[model samples]
Target: MNKQGTFVAVATSILAMAAAGSASAAESGKFQIKAFATKVAVDGAITKVKVDQLRLPAGADTRAKDAWVPTVAAEYFFSPRVSVETICCVTQHDVRGSGPLNGAALVDNAEVIPATVTVKYHFPLSSGVKPYVGAGPAYFMVFGEKVGASARALGATKVGLSSELGAALQAGVDIPLPGKAVGLSIDVKRYFVDTTAQFRAGDRVVLETKHKLDPWVASAGVAWRF
Candidate 1:
């Protein structure tokens, strides 16, 4: 009712509002969304190849080129320190034959898509950076398999790859940008995937291969927290 009382009331309301905002910033909501440009490199060599159940010694040395993939992830925070994330990405690799059949003579290229789910633990630091570690399972689906011109000339008719299940380990850090709601994120992950490739001529199988596609995925991008 008085001038001094009115001033005190306004000041108290402003301070309370500020305190509520700060508390909200300190703790994120139940969900977050992240998008990233990721570069994935396949580090493991092909385990080996087989022809109609007979092993090909030279195919053991086959390799696939690295790929650049665009990726996205959605996360749900269960607590202030724990969250679950689901990530997805599609990548293509050029398969090169090795040893005696060295070159792109046997296999040309293939595309792989993976969906991964991980549980992450975050450590928030005073410097406005949050570091986290995660581990989980990944399911990979392979497609667009093709035999090279040389292999086709040699009577190859069809090529196919089987889907596989694997595990992944990841680490990342999020740095708050000038706007506290947006942040920069850098992440690195490794997926331990093993798959089998089957090559056929007519209705009969010809060459079969085992691929250890344990790849390292590195990404740098942004995330928004509500």
Candidate 2:
């Protein structure tokens, strides 16, 4: 009923609002959504050659080849301390020149689709920047080829298949932006998997090889908190 009473009511309302906001900030914190892209140098362990479904041949070069691939991933935070992420990407490798034999030549090139489900844990740190690390497993399916001008090419044959029991390691940092709800992040990851390919003629295995595919992934993106 008086000016002093009116001023007290306004102050009380403001204080109540501030208290509610602080309580929300302390409850579950907030969840963040992040999306990013990365570059990886994929390498393999070995390449084996077989002849007429019988004789096995080994190449002098054992070093896995390297390829640069572009990848994208996304993550969702259930709370400030934990989150889940899923990744999907493709990879390409070059053709290594090899000995020739029959008219059949194995052409060289490979592509794969790999996906993973991972759990992330964030450590308590200073208010400005947050850093985290994660580990998980994945599944990879790929199609590959080895080519030669001649089918008789000794080990030019290539096949494609799927592999399981994949592993991944990743690290990233979150930097606060102007808005309390937005931030930027830089992240990197590595994936390890395997594949099997074979050269066959009329149901006979001609040239068979195993590949060890290791991919290094990197990316940068913006994150929003809600």
Best by lDDT: 1
Question: What's the lDDT for residue 60 in model 2?
Answer: 28
Tell me, what's the RMSD of every candidate? 14.9, 16.0
Model 2, which residues run further than 4 Å from truth? 1-31, 47-59, 62-70, 95-109, 144-152, 155-158
Instruction: Mark the regions of model 1 whose C-alpha exceeds 4 Å error after superposition.
Output: 1-29, 52-60
1-226 per-residue lDDT for model 2 (tens digits): 5433543454355345434544544335345667665566665544444333534333322233455545445667555656667876676554343332212233445566677766665554777787877666668766654443443444334344446557676678888886567788888777766665555655667655576666777777777766
Q: Model 1 over residues 1-226: C-alpha lDDT tens digits?
A: 8433543454455345434544555455578788999998885366765554434554346667888877888998766666778987788887776676577456566888888887777778988788987777789888887976866776778878788988777789988887578889999987878888787889888777687888889999989887
Q: Which candidate achieves the best TM-score against the true structure?
A: 1
Q: Please give the CA lDDT of all the candidate structures.
A: 0.76, 0.58
- TM-score of each predicted structure versus truth: 0.81, 0.67
